[model samples]
Target: MKRITVAVLLLMSFTTRYGGQQTPSRPTVLEHVTVINAGSAPMSDMTILITGSRIVAVDRADATTIPTGAQIIDGRGKFVIPGLMDMHHHLLNGSFPPRPGGIQANLGRLLAVGVTTVFDPSIGRQDFARLKAAAAPDSSAYARFFGTGPMFTVKGDTFADADSPMPETPAQAEAAVNDLKALGVDAIKIQRDDLSWAIKGSGTLMPLEVLAAVVKQAHTQGLKVYAHAPLLKLAKEALSVGVDGLMHGIVDEPVDAEFLGLMKKNGAVYVPTLALFEDVADVAAFARRQAVNWDRAKLQPPAIYAPFADAAGARQIESFLNNSAFTKERLKVARANVKRVFDAGVPVVLGTDTGFFGVFLGVATQIELELLVEAGLTPAEALRAATINAARMIGKERDLGTIEAGKFADLVILDADPLADIRNVVRIYKVIKGGVQYEPVDPATPR
Candidate 1:
């Protein structure tokens, strides 16, 4: 994929912020909406007051008056929740074997699905550097994109290739981290497994000594480090090495007391990214059996994804769908382990690994929330994973997670109650990002 210069991308991103209109920092009120904030029960007939981009008040409609001259929105019978976050997102144009697309359009598609914040765990440094430079400060036009500028992997690791900085020693690991920090990345992501382990059944895993050194260097720089560990042993190694988060579920087997202890000691956040395994299996199985009766929902493709739709990306999805059985057992193990880990008191964060070929952006977030519930978490718990828990994972808990006074007014208005059914989250009626109303893209349209 060709890269769009920062200037061009920023211009396109700016236009999307206010829907080609001037963005206002004025007052607004959402009246009589059913509020669900901070993992609590629904509070109906509430009026949430917003001034500029911060929520000023969340009061009962009968108790407080709407500010004069403020734009008033009737939110009757609508369920209001914090704007969703995807802790494990990606940009196909920025990953290995780059796909064609502009970043701005993809960001818009993410917003269209009510995702106000996104964290890409593994992104190429050059791509992240360009995006960081292009995005405007205090811009509300697109969902937030934070990431680790490329992933740290060993020479023989799955993602190793030209441009990949494969560290071979502990000294190299620390140096690699320092290089990433210099690029102004938000966090550090380390790859622990090789890609071929799933298909060809042969791959080299990153050594523990090197990972520990990487984690130490990252923490010294005040950056949280996340590890891409898909198996139980590798997950334990990452946790024991003091990684701040695990990017995938601990599959291959159930967790044990020692694993729980390691997680507790390190306070590592678990981001199952269940959709990665699940989608791979589902698509692959369907394609293998040539099933056609399934509902093939259409997703609107942002202009940036056009190149992907036409080239190797399209072929990759077909190839993956034809190999669904490869991930079937792995996904089952992940589902079981997620439940056990959550039951053991580990914090679970929501991440969909969207933008990986078939993984749709905004739509995947809602699906992930439902999957969380299916893995033995209550709806409230699952909501928190995407909200406050997600915010916590990225160390932005005070600024952008939940819908609370003095926090950024990023919220989603649902046509039905999500507490009654998690699927209601996809019934997006309206989206408010940084206190500005955003028109959402219909998820039904195929991209």
Candidate 2:
């Protein structure tokens, strides 16, 4: 076994070692391992070869030939799975006071914990470009970044804030999509609720007519549209307009037959951020959880959200979490709806809405997987939501989200089988992103 020393990892060159020596440039090999490709059964005694940033080969250990000068990783008892993704998150760090670049500092922690990919539904073009540049392959620490540039909302939407692009008419909606495309966004996020008032009282939710036009125009530019509709009514409206995905779960009530049928017919992906709802549903419990884990998270290197991890930030988060936004019964329905959606053949993907409230980055993706399993998804199926299904949602299936030949070599080496216990996802032994290897996080001292 080899150790990865943090001191040797250069921020500029992106280099690594096998046994405390300079690694060769030929290729990297993981020999005699068990692989879970998410959509398929586990394959044992396999050899995975990485050259440059792509996986060049995946064959049985006995049939594969060892290339000269290649760095070989002994994986006799390891299990490998594709790097996980947090499909719903916020990318901007400006909201947090006392420090800026919050999201930028978390890039290294994201890669350290096997979150090699992330999808932020709300971000500005400038921030997205900065995140993308920070996560470039040549950088020593980063996660593959994909996001919607500036979420769309109504004129007075509370979540819209100052950074959101508010579109009031069909023409404005069309222009908004065009502007986002011009900014090189990977997708468009449209909010169907104002959130300033009660869900039922919020006036002038993004008009359905305008939303339809936005969806149509975004499709013309080949960008997927993700809907942020927290309530069932709003979600139904978003679905009626044919958005590609729903970024939040239907928490107010169980999804009805009409919504399920619409989802099935339209092939709309669902990202049930159950963990987030759990935090919001039981504020006392959430506060307790925060009190216990806040220190550990703050100890992490780079301190991505150092401002938010401080006493003032903790007080703010506690005040926010203590507010009873949704009922306990609502969360029950939300969980049931997630199970129902999964059983009904709707694509239920894993997402934790990280970078908001108590949903920490790096670790939230793992919690989301466990929550999915609890919501009646098989471990493999839950894994798919974070891997292949997520990639497919963003039209990136051909390049990422799996351990296959010709795919980016982004993977996680685990000490235990996640199939047996979803919690094993946290027991990471190593992380490899874009064929670049990294030391895994120790749960006792995560950094």
Candidate 3:
């Protein structure tokens, strides 16, 4: 594996100019690479020309002309794919009292694992501002961040934050959407499901009329609404009311034809965070059979596992294990729903609900891809879920997603073809964000 050592040069070009005149810097080119463009056939032996932050050209290596002073990365035997997107991520600030240094560490880990973009479905106004600042394009590292600032839900909902709007009427819901629009949120997130399965108490469901108002106002404001509806009934209600996407799989029951029809009618996307449900079951299974071993833990990476390696972690695992039956059933139903959704031609975007209990940040995205494959999507289809489909969900398909000319040069180079095996996505050779190449993080180090 060849490592590209041009970070210093790339950083310098961002600010440096020759003779007091801003001259175009030499383009960086990836030559003779197998491009696995999401939603399209793979193109072999292609040359990708990148200038500044955009891919300027993608052509056959033999037919393309390299610039006079281009920085060429020999991409022989390597596979390049568009950077992965996590549509339903939650930043560290969402944690109770928030974790110190969590934002920087999480961002680094996410980018290290080829996740160049992430959409946080729930964040407070101040936290969203902070995240936006940290993820600015000028920063050398960090995933491109978009978020819904403060979800809309009823009071006493399990997922509700202090700032979350507990709208009682249609006007209040509209006001909440206006407030989020003022906060510059990329979308609206509505929590409508009772989370009693995870939490002890029976959670409150948001009123359908208020939910409808929120969706309508968000759409009127040119923003999409992504509803957190884990049950079949809630999902149907959200779809009927015009929510643009479901933030989780329908876990209560298998989705029927009517639900699929509503999804198609509303042009909605399904984000089955399968890795989340699987993580719960995995933790339960691990607790039932063996003691905690950080290295051997299936879900938690070392850095995430470190904090919960003691007695507390054991208790947490025990609690989940006690509810193993529910978690396992949810995982089963979620997987089935994903396959049905994909087979029905509805767009299925990849998300892992990262930042939740037991879900590691960077590695969780890869797990989601694998789970997508396990749910009956081909490796290529899974790639599309994480790439082009995610972009479409976020309304950034034009600038992000697919490897093509005039798109952001956010890409991942793999030593092995992910099309052959989805796990090969972890065999990252290099990650390029905004045309700047970054070396993958060493797993031996703490995240």
Candidate 4:
């Protein structure tokens, strides 16, 4: 596939900003529509001049603001926001080799809903390479995908597992770290020792020592470590070693001020992949919805996901959740949990942990954001978690998460102001990825 050179595709008419520094000047002549300046001290009516892909100039939306020799776009009643981002999302289906068109669907849905950037914290190294290739500017089919493969895990450990295809030894772990570095794995993921062995006694699993060594060695190789910690002893150990980030919310045991202070000192980022739990809930709900008079449906198969669905699955699972929820009142617990964590100042980033669970990438992300708000974030704060703050988490602060010039041209145009109502973010009008414009879908069109 042909790649678009930044020299060629990047702004010349109007300065552009996508994961870059210094907002470029808007075009003296305009094309698309009004420009929206986000992250400003006071966001008001600001018009951006667009000459092709570059934004040349920015000025108030007054009659005199229109430049001569510029093609005017109707900006009367629309809003333009910097493209949205998802810090922790699985690549499409999240399995090795992934699935055909799965990444494409995820990206499309993301762009459709104004998500222009995603950081896939967990991915197969092999799969990561494929996704990275597909995300190249020229032939890419989705929003930008930044990924990290298997965590440093030992053979058959139980908390988390490695998925580099072949088993890894201490020596092999060092080589694995080297291989991932050579292949440009974005960051190293670590979880309370790789525990796949306990799950099935798979001999291929790496031991906790090996996993820790992997993290230690990967750090030497200049890779950041992200862990699926649950405040377990191993998690504390991982933290004590100074991981760069912690994956998953502080489940199992609630994090205290002491833990938060430690994390703060370590400069570790926390990605609460809360939607994973909701995914299980959603699946049960989906199943229950499917069983409603499945035999009477008119489709050729009668009902789409019925035969394979366990009719009693929902009730069975609900019984367990009911007990759990009733015990702690899950929502109340989660809310209190978030308040505790946030009040302690643990750096938070948005993540949905899609692909493995029933949660689809793009769809589940929005749900995560909604839940984040429910967990005590103002919509703007939640937006920052998905955008600017997330970028900071991956150490990509100067690159893509926010809107500024010289940044990657990843962006989303929304019809509504998300800061006002996060849910309105779904009302996306257009998406721009690396300077390529993706026109919005007309809902009236048949799927």
Every candidate's lDDT? 0.71, 0.73, 0.76, 0.56
| Comparing 2 and 4 on lDDT, the stronger one | 2
Question: Native-vs-model 1 lDDT?
Answer: 0.71
> 1-447, model 2: which lDDT tens digit per residue?
222211111111135321111232455788899999887999999988777677777888887777666667899999999988778866432133323456765666676668888888987778988877666543235677889978988766656667687877889888989988988889999888544212234456766898899999999999889998877878888888888889988887788899999888789999998867865565335434443333434324335444344667656654544434544557778888989998899998888877665555556667778788888888999999999999988888998888998888889999899999988887778887776677674322212
Which pairs clash (backbone N, Cα, C closer than 3 Å) in model 2? Answer: none
TM-scores of the models, in the order given: 0.86, 0.86, 0.87, 0.75
Compose the digit string of candidate 3's lDDT tens values, residues 32-75.
99999876889999888887777777888887766666778899
- Model 2 regions lying over 4 Å from their true place: 1-24, 91-99, 136-140, 194-204, 287-325, 442-447
lDDT of 4 by residue, 393-439 (tens): 76776756655555555556666777678776666565655544555
Model 4: how far residue 440 lies from native, Å: 3.8
Lowest lDDT 10-residue stretch of candidate 2: 4-13
- Which parts of model 3 are misplaced by more than 4 Å? 1-25, 93-101, 138-140, 284-303, 306-312, 317-324, 442-447
Give the alpha carbon lDDT tens digit for every residue of 338-430 in model 1: 888888888899997776655554566777887889888888898988999999888889988877887888899989988889888877787
Which candidate ranks first by TM-score, i.e. highest? 3
- How close to the true structure is residue 308 of candidate 2, measured as C-alpha lDDT? 45
Listed per candidate, the RMSD to the true structure in angstroms reads 7.8, 5.8, 5.7, 7.9
Q: Would you list the rank order by TM-score, best first?
A: 3, 2, 1, 4
The residue pairs in collision within model 1 are 17-141, 101-304, 102-304, 123-150, 284-321, 298-445, 298-446, 299-445, 299-446, 299-447
Model 4 worst lDDT window (10 residues): 1-10
Go through the candidates in order and give the clash count of each. 10, 0, 0, 33
